[model samples]
Each structure stands twice: as structure tokens, then as C-alpha cells.
Target: MANLAAVVGIGQTKYTTKRGDVSIAGLVREAAANALEDAGLGWDDIEAVIIGKAPDMFEGVIMPEIYLTDALGCNGKPMLRVHTAGSVGGSTALVAASHVQSGTFKRVLTVAFEKQSESNAMWALSTPQPFSVHLNAGAGGYFAPIIREYMRRSEAPYDVGIKVAVKDRLHGARNPLAHLQKPDITLQEVEESFMLWDPLRFLEACPSSDGACAMVIASEDLAEQSPKPPAWIRGVAMRSEPTMYAGREEVSPQAGRDCAADVYQQAGITDPRRDLDCAEVYVPFSWYEPMWLENLGFAAEGEGWKLTMEGATSLDEGGDIPWNPSGGVLCSNPIGASGMIRFAEAARQVRGDAGAHQVEGAKLALGHAYGGGAQFFSMWVVGSEKS
Candidate 1:
């Protein structure tokens, strides 16, 4: 088996709807430099670079990573580009960690991003594909049915979605790097927002953000030499199934459950709600907060909504098992970089480096991501102390 790897540095750009000031290369470089600075190291210290994103078409530039090699300081260094839809960010980080865990590289840099301002996401998603009819209008259109099914089966209250949206947007207010920091937002405001899809409002959907997130992973030996404390990787896993398979449950995806189980077993977690200090889950739609709760084994089937209703997922008093303290995907959706942001945020909490959103004395954290009809799943567990 390979040796354990730890995150020595984490960095992300200020997320926004349109970062027209910088080119894609410039945007990635900004995040890479911040990570290097946080590690108290320089580009000369990096051994390899791994870049990931949803699709090249999103940025209107094919194989943009090739042109960004120089910007990421990958000149003459081994470089790899990964694409697995929205899970690309988390998978990219895992690939970089593997290199260090294998003892093949002392230090590795991983980065993920999206320049959604260059194109409209609705058009990109609705674009016609060969032999397939474009039935759904956009992501909201595709997911609305699943959300409706969840509501029907669970008999959840109509206000549950609105509550989740309010909570995440409130949490986003605490994160300076978040794209939408609506501090004064209220539940009533979310309910009053325009409905984008049935049971999904305009505020419930994630914004098309232009941003990048980067991290530096190193072997145990190299981690001990780093200036900042490292967040040790306990377990990592990725799983995929057909986008639309027979007997598939889109509302509560089995792929997510299997992915979580694999990681939990590897990390020796028997009960996620009690074992995990905090979680950074992919919540592009607010309702996912509860859906993922059951899928991740935090609650029994049909009981995920109880956690949200009782405020157990909040960061405030009387709440436990806080989720998305970094405002999560609802605050920023760079698509390609979204998943890595979750992983990086979890690492930050464990490293005791999460600025204002830091969970007090956080020791263990879960980072999760899913994409493509909820068929692709990637997850990782990180802890403050080496496992």
C-alpha cells in the first residue's frame, strides 16, 4: 500500500459571476500562487501539476491546461489534466494525493477552475447532443423532478427547501471568498424568490461562478518540514455508474452511498454524524443538503429532512454535524472547481486555517462531490492528526 499524504497548503480565488479582468491562465495562477505562499514555499518546490475541469467547451478553449502549464509553474514538470464532469475537481485532488502517497513525488500541486462568464451555462447544458433529445431546459429542470420525487416519498414539508437555502446563504456571509454573501437574507426572502423550477427558487440554484481552487499535497516526510500544519488524508474514494440505469433512484443515489461507505470504511468511521467534525458537501441545490444526509448514512432513509428541520446542520448553537460552513456550492459554483473547493475547505478546517468559517477544534472532516445525474461520486476524509 502507498504511504499517507497530507495537504500542506490550500488557496482559492474570490468567487464571482464574471471575473473579466483576468484570462483563464491568470485566474489559475492567482490560486496557485496563494497555495504556494500558504505553504511558505516557491514554485521550485513543486514536483508535478494536475489540472481539472468539467469540460473544455465551458471555457470555449479546448485543452486550456496545456496553455496554462507555464502559468501554473509546470514548465518541464509532469502535468496531467482530468475531466469527469463536476467531480473532476475532487478526482483531480485525489490523483495528486496518490502521487505523493505512492512516494513518487515529494510535493504536488492540484488546481481546478471554470470561467462560466465566457459562456451561458443554460445554453451549454441544453445544447443538443447526438441521438438524445434535450428534454430538460437546464440543471434546475433536470433536478426538479428528482426533488419532487424526494418530496413525495418522504412527505417533506414544502418549506424545507427554503430553509436550507436560507441557512447556506447565511453561512456564505461568513466566507469572504464566497461569491454570494447575503448576510441579511431570511427564510421569507428565499420563499418569496422567483421559482426557477418546481420546489426550486432562483436563490436555491447555484450561481455561475468564475473562480479556481488549488491545493498542495505532500508525503508525510515532506509534510513534517512544512511551515503550516498539514491535514492528513485518511481515506479517498471515487465511484461511477450509468447515468440512467434501471432501478436507479435519482433522489437518493446509490452511488453516493457506496462512495461514502467505501471512504468511511477506509477511514474507520462507523457513524458519520458523530465521527465527523464538519462536512463540505456539494449542495448546488439546497434540497441536496437533506438528500445527501440520508445517502451519506448520516440519517436513515426519509429522515434526512428531520436534520434540516431541527437545525442540526446549522453552524449555530444547538446544532451539531455542521455542513458547508464555507457557504458551499450554493454560494459559488465554478462547476469544475466546485468539488475541489469542498475538499480544500475541509482540509482548511482540519489545518486550523479556515479564516472566519473555521469550526472550533475541528479534528475530522468529510469532503464530498457528485455529478452527471448523480451517478459520479468522489469523497475524502481528512483529519488534523496523521492517521
Candidate 2:
């Protein structure tokens, strides 16, 4: 049987459009240092290092892990790099956890970062590739139509997306590290915002951010010895499918459903809405909040939008299951690091360390991320108890 693993430390750099004070190496190093400090461990304590990020073009740097090894204190230790588009962050953390769970390492450090300000991310992601269609522009162009499709099928109120935009921005105001701070954002402001992509308004879409996230995963024994409370890894799962296929359900991809199902089963959860205290899902666009609620089994098909309308996912509204107390990707999107931010925030909730945004007495939480035309999916369930 595999050994148990948990998150002993979590860290994140302030999310913003540009972090001119530091280079890419410095960006990641800052987060890594914070994670080590939080864990009360030194560089020598980390047995292995794993890093993840978006494509090399996003930062104009190829094979960043090679040069970053020394910065992360992995000079003579094993180092690995993981890439799964936007889902890279969550998957990278999972890989680090597996190293300890599989009895291959006692303690491991995982880092994910994206300096989008340094490079033209839209151009990098939209560049023509062989055998792939490029009819759409960047992510907004690709996902806008999908959102429309979901709206048509679900017949959800048009204001649902607007409500999510305001709610998450309000949530972001409470997160000191969040990129956008809209303490008093209103639905009227969102409704009046210019439409970037039909249904997606300027405020409804996530901002381009330059930031990083890091975590320290340790074996059960090491986790128990840590100074801070550890968020036990109850379950972790990843799934993927071809980006383009005939009859593909882009609204709620099957890969996402399977991944969520797998993780829920491992965590012994039959009803996510009732069993989980909260969720930090990857929702770069406001509409994705309800879309993912259904995909993750938090709501029945075609009924997810109702939850948003009823404030079920709002932390400040005293909802039953708050979705993004840390403001989620909608408020801070560093692409590669966004997903891991979700995972880290979930851990923070369970550890009772999420400062102003903490869900009261949260014992279990969910973290989720999806990327690559919504084909790549990664998720994890975490809890305060080891069982």
C-alpha cells in the first residue's frame, strides 16, 4: 500500500498583471522560500523538487527547470518538470505528493509559476500548430461559444454570470494576495462593462497575472511533526481526453466528470454538496463557476446555475458550500499557477489558516482545475482528519 501524504506548507506570491521587481527565477524562488519557511524546514529537508508552468513561449524561456534547480535548492537532488497547460499547477502538486505516497521520497517541494507579463501569452497560446484548428483567438474566444452553448442548454438566467463576477470580486477583496480587489463590486458595474466575447464581459473574465504558488508535501510522520496543521490529502486524480473530437461534450467534458468521480470515490464522498465544506475551482470566466459545479457533482445537471443564483457558492452570503473564498481564478489567474492556487486554498481552508476568507470550521474541501480546451482535468479532496 502507498504511504499517506499531506501538505505541510503552502505559499503564494501576490498576483498581479506585472511583477517587475523580480525575474522568473526570483518569482519562483520567493514562493519556494515562503513554503519552506511555513514548513519550518530548510533546503536540505526537501528530498526532491518538482516544478510546473505553462509553455516555454509564455516566458520566452525554454527548459526553465534546468536553470531553476539551483534556485529551488535542488542542486544535487532529483528534480522533475510537469506541464499540462493550465492544469499543470494542480497536477504538479499531485506528482510531488505521489513521490511521498509511493515511498520514493520523505518530503518534496512543488512549485508552479507564470510570468505572463514578460511574454505575449495570447500570441503564444494562439500560434498556429500542425493538425490543430485555430479558428478562435485566445481562451476567451474558444470558451465564449462553449458558455453560450451551456446557457442555451440550461436556459439559465443571463444574470447568473454577472452575479458570479461580483461575488468573486467581493471575495477577492478579502484576499491580500489576490490580483483584483473589488470590495464593493456591483452587478450593475458588471452589466455595464464592455463585452469582450459576447456573453463574457471585461469584468467577467480573469485578469492576466504574473505570480507563483508552492507547497511542501511530506509523509504522514513528517506532516505530524510540522509546526502548522497539515491538510491531509484524502484523494487526488487527473484525467484527459483529445482536445478535438466529433461529438465531444465541451460544456461538461467527460474527462472532468471521471476525474471528479475518481477523487470523490477515493475520499468516500457520495454527495459533494453535503460532504464537502467548500471548493476552489478553476473558473477563469465567470460562467465556469456554475458549469463546474455540475461537472464536479456539486449540483445536478442543468441545475448548477440555480446554486449561483441562490448564493450557495458565496462565502460572505453564509452559503452552505462556498466555492472560492480565496477569490479563485476569476480574481487571480497566473495560468500555470492558477490551478495549484485552487488546491492550496482548499488546503488552507481545512487547515484553518485562510485568514479573512476562511470558511468557518471547514473540515473538508475540494480543489479543481481544467485546461487545454477543457480536456485536461485535475482535482483533489483534502480534510483536517487523516482518516
Candidate 3:
């Protein structure tokens, strides 16, 4: 009693460090309106609304969905909110797809945003929690040791991270909505930048941006009537583990591996590297490009770094399976919206809607996001042809 779901519309705001011109509600409304326009539909066409964001403490606004409904024209429609730390965006999109796939709704709107301009995410992240002792200062501090361990196990060169930073930034330069436009960023510059953590440089980390991303998901019948070609949802999966657990593998978390395996199986992908034309993975830190490359089965365990060094993931480098052609989180990170942006970008690629960063002949794509000590994992597969 389930049906197919497809993304009929995708929208994103111009990511930046601050958006002083609009309130948080206004920011989300802008993205929602854009998505509605892209779908060639009006507010009444949507039957439900799902919104997501990081902690309200990040913005000092509690229960934002109550007020956001009005801005989204969801006054009388069913509205829901989902949260999973940084993976919230991807999870939100999956939830919206579920409503359509379950045959409970014909169409739904999903949006995720983060107004980091008014919120101090770093401060909130660094705060101490009751059960966990956070010896690491910030995200970088926590992930640095894990990255170092991967380097030791893989024996990757020291410049592999630098190469990834430059590659993603170069990809970001092609995206007009990216926050940090460094088309000319060099590996030497990244290598020389100040080291925030033991192995992560200032340039190798993602920027805290203020923006939102929205998507319109519709059932098979509604999607067939869309004005634009639909990116058919092939599969979706989510998995989570405790924040800190004994004998946990932080470098390549089991949750992430299992989630990818589940989604790929649903999509009938026996080899992610061969089946997917491109990918938009969550790589907040530069080293994560290689780490996730392995975790996602793009490469063999210790050989993921070799793919990066060979420019296999670079769009401008004429790589076959380009990753993050839209610049990715390294270029613009709207916290709660980052993962949705990745999912949307993958859809854009499959629909042949990605402009300058378009992966040629991209009929299949993968979008992935992870959070909370790499314990939370969400992934989806999309294709031009419905599965």
C-alpha cells in the first residue's frame, strides 16, 4: 500500500555568514516560496509541511514550527518538525518523502534552515553535557583525533586533506549560492593556514552560514504531472548510535556504513562507485572527504585517500564520479540546512538541473549526511528514472 515519491522542486537561499535583512521566519519563507515557484504550484497545492533545524538554543527560539507554519502557508495543513543534530536536514527530507510514499499524502513541502548569524553554534556546541565529558573544545577538536587515526591507518599523505579543501572550494566557486567563493584557493594556502585543531586547518573547515533549503516531494501521479523532470526517490535510510560508547569506531562509524548499505540495497546498487554518477556527502572538515569516501563504499578502506590525491572526486578535474559538484558544506554550512542542500543538489544533478556544476549524463546520484560524533547517519539515492 505504498507508492513512489519524487522530488518535484528544490530551492536554496544564497548562503552567507549573516542575513541581517530577514528574520529566521522570513529566511525560511524565502526558500519555501522559491521551491513553490520552482514546482509551478501555489501554497494550496501542498497538503503537508515538514520543517527541521538544529537545537532551538542555537537560535534562542523555542518551537519554531508553531510560528513557521504561518510563514509557510501551513496554517491549516499538517505540520511536523524533525531533528537529528546535523543530520536533521537529510532526515527531514526523508520524513517528507515517507508521507508521499506511504500513500498518506499526495504532496508535501520540506524545509530546513539555520540562522547562524543570530546564534552562536560554536558556543552551544562547546557547552558541557551531563552524561558526556567533552574534552574536545569544538567539532574540529573532537574530530581531529579521529582524523589522525585514519591517517595513521591509511598512511595517507599529509597534503591529502589540503588537496580535498582546494578541490571542494574550487567546486564551490562554480556555485553562485556558495558562501565562500575561492575559485583560486590553492593547496599551499590551505597548508599554510592556521591550524584550528591538531590536523585541521582554518581553510579546511566548513563555514557557519545563514540560509535555508527546501524541497517539494510528491507521489508518483503528482510527480508525473510536474512541469520539470522529477528526481525519483530510489531509496532512503537513517541510522543512529549513542554519542559515546565503548569500543566505538569513530573514524568510520558502523551506523554510517550500515545506513549506506541499506540505502544502496534498496536502490539496487551493488557498487556505489559504479552505480552513482555523483555524490554530495557531508564533509564539514576537509579530511572527511576521504574518510566518507571510504565509509560510503566509494573506495576500499585504506585507498579512499588515493582517490582524493588522484582528483577522482573533483568536477573540474574531469573525474567520472565527481563529489560535491556544488561546492558542498566546505563552502556553505547552514547547520540544519546543510544536509538538505546535499540531498537537493543530488536531485539537481539527476534532473540535469545543476547549471555550471552539472555532472554530465548524471542519471543516478547519492546524498549523505552524518552528525553527532559521526553516530547519526542518513542517506538517500535518487535517479532520473523511477525505481
Assess candidate 3 and give its lDDT.
Answer: 0.94
Q: In lDDT terms, how accurate is model 2?
A: 0.94
| Candidate 2: residue 372 lDDT (0-100) | 91
Worst 10 residues of 1 by lDDT: 119-128
Tens-digit per-residue lDDT, 190-263, candidate 1 = 88999999889998889889999999999998899989999999999999989887888788887888999999
Which pairs clash inside model 1? none
Candidate 2 total steric clashes = 0
Per-residue lDDT tens digits for candidate 2, residues 184-244, read 8999999999999989999999999999999999999989999999999999999999988
After superposition, the stretches of candidate 1 with alpha carbons farther than 4 Å from their true spots are none
TM-score of predicted structure 1: 0.98
Query: For model 2, what is the error of residue 133's alpha carbon versus the real structure, in angstroms, after optimal superposition?
Result: 2.9
